[model samples]
Target chain A: MVKVHFTSHLRHVAPSDPVEAAGATVADVLTDVFARHPAVRGYVLDDQDRIRLHIAVFVDGTHVRKDILAAPVTPASEVYVLQALSGG
Target chain B: MAERLYVSTRKGLLVYARDAKTWKHHATHFLGAPVSIVLPSADNQTVFCALNLGHFGAKLHRSTDGGVTWTELEPPKYPKVETSDAAEKEKAPAVAQLWSMAWAGPDKPGALWAGTTPGLFYSKDLGATWELNEGLWNMPERARWFGGGTIDPALHAICVDPRNSNRVAVAVSCGGVTVTEDGGKTWRVAGKGLRAEFMPPDQQFDPVIQDVHMLAQSPSHPQMWWVQHHNGIFVCTDDLQSWDEITTAPISHFGFPVAVHPKDGNTAWFVPAKKDEHRYPVDGNMVVNRTRDGGKTFETLRRGLPQGQCFDLVYRHGLAVDETGDHLAMGSTTGGLWTSPNGGDDWMLLTAHLAPIYAVRFA
Candidate 1:
């Protein structure tokens, strides 16, 4: 099981507290999280179902730089979703 | 004259309501979001706002109770195309911006037209659902279309014929003008006389590749149309079969917004700015060029306008004329808003500060 957490910015639109989900990869964990909060999917991914250009995902405190969705995640990993600081 | 106004800006949607003779800031919506377009339905009861959120992509909302309450609505989306892989799929299209929108003729209620970064969309249920006009998208000539001011090639102009809802005209910044007589069923390239000086000599006069900044049609004379092109200004009274360039602009011919008179075809106004890379007021003088006798003559009206060391750039949707054609409102990139009660002859500064106005409309 992995603990998924969303930043405060996204919390305004979806859940704020962390939730535990079972998955083997970051995408799998997110897929499980989205299943519960469907509206969060659009805030995290673009129309092409890809992680947004200005969003970052971290698994077990390690930044998933490339092939983000397919990045491997341990059973007891901490996944953090946050917006990048570049838009302004 | 209109008593209320809607201003879409970089930070949010600003509403100005008329209190007696003064316009006051009435409300704000979607604070901190980049509102690209704000449109009111034909009856002025339903208002729609398009937002280009930096991280969340494009979104839309509509208000039925005079903007006091809103309902989230699905924006136009592109059909997925088959791609080999994620890297190669970068070329796949998406709606970068909802550039422009228009209500269909009064006869066709609940019908709305929208121009996006790469395609035209039609909504039959007041934006509840949208369908792309594949006829225009599938045209082979669309290959020539490229990005102009926007990051992606955009269709920014939509003019539905006043007499017949079936006849419509749309202009793409870098893809010339196209018209359809049977609504969105079919389309044909128009603007024969438009010139694209940026293209090669042989293709300079090609109608399929003109970068039209904006297109406007006179409400009283439906056949009369005006275009603010990349190279200059043009007018076509023959329903866009051909265009005649206007060479008598007192200021630089380059501009973005063009508002035609409601009761007279020959009366129109444009906010001229430096062309191309430098898009500010000409010689630091902000003025609105008014032409009452068509393009043959123009009056450089600058009364009450800023001159000398000014840097205001009015975008395509920044200028609007009311139903009577005597009231006009103009906003600028430098956060300036001005209004004219008696046409463009004089102006009154509404506000010196607002979030870099993107579009303004009379309500």
Candidate 2:
């Protein structure tokens, strides 16, 4: 069971508790989360089904920059979805 | 059932009151040229405006008892030095144009902070006196890069942590975000996730210029912040230590402003424009996008806004929300003054004639 922490703003639509998903890849975990929380899907995925430009995902403390959300995940691993920063 | 909207334009300040559902314009030549920023104090008893006075230099004006009359606040004078090289020191810091201003204490009425083109200035005696926060001006990085150049190391936005008055965050354009944890004695650059990729090839060594135009902190979560940059929109959870890109809008890269809903952390808004050379609107058509889920997605709101050939540039300091709980989004375009009451779902033309608006605030 991997633990994914949603930021405060996302907590509105996300599960009240950290979600538990059994998956070998990041994509599988997200798929499970989306199945439970449909409203969050549009927030993270664009029309092309690509990870939205504004959404950033991280495993542990490092950023995962890839098109495929199928990055490796372990039962004890942690995931985080970050809201983007902008302006000058 | 109309609303009265006050707008500052190039010609001067104008009052547009709603009558029978139509906006009527009343112009006042309170300032010469276009106004850059308008700040209404917390009590709504004072309206302070920054006006671009051409070669005469930028001036700050104040009006008490609403906008009935105005008085120009004399620019604060720093002690002059008499030396053998008087010529060099005599030259004023190239006409410091005020970019942004904020009133700090709700309990202490007169506490105010103002950010200008040259540096940051503060006042405890309302607008009667001023003192420059030299700690920000004396930044070594400012002198090495932005100094002597057109870019001012001045603060663009100063946010006093509602939870802790001493905890302050100031957005310094071209200087990144500076935070003071122990009051204003010490400050540090909090630009980790942000990059300044727009810099010249030679200056590529510098972190991408995270020219933060606006910074909004969630009242519920002080660590969470939303920053509007020339490059893109960013969100930070660790007091700006790290950031995530939450702007996936069609024109995400080229917006000048960002406004977070005062009550809802999940609800925030921004204006979008084409990137690169096509940044400004080609015609009169423009759009205001609001992100109900913290900028993960944006829906364009264009009910009453112009659609055809319109040039509407919603500047950095333009759009803002009032304490009344109604979202008041204002913009300065080649066209005139526009306001949106129901978030950004629909907008109304408040005025038809005025100079390009540089800034707008409820107070």
Highest lDDT, which number? 1
Residue A16 Cα positional deviation in candidate 1, in Å, after optimal superposition? 1.2
| Candidate 1: stretches off by over 4 Å | none
For model 2, the stretches where C-alpha displacement exceeds 4 angstroms are A1-88, B1-5, B16-31, B77-83, B86-92, B144-154, B200-208, B282-284
User: Tens digits of per-residue lDDT for model 2 on A4-72?
Assistant: 877665664577667887788888888888898876664565433446555678987778887438689
Instruction: Summing lDDT over every window of 10 consecutive residues in candidate 1 chain B, give the lowest-scoring window.
Output: B84-93
What are the per-residue Cα lDDT tens digits for candidate 2 across B79-165?
333444545543435434677777765755787778776466777877877887777666665554352124455567888888777
**TM-score of structure candidate 1:** 0.96
Estimate TM-scores for all models: 0.96, 0.71
* Candidate 1 lDDT tens digits, B140-219: 88888888976788898899988888899999989989999888888899979999889999998999889999999888
| Model 2 C-alpha RMSD to native | 26.1
- Residue B361 in model 2: lDDT: 61
lDDT of all the models against the reference? 0.88, 0.67
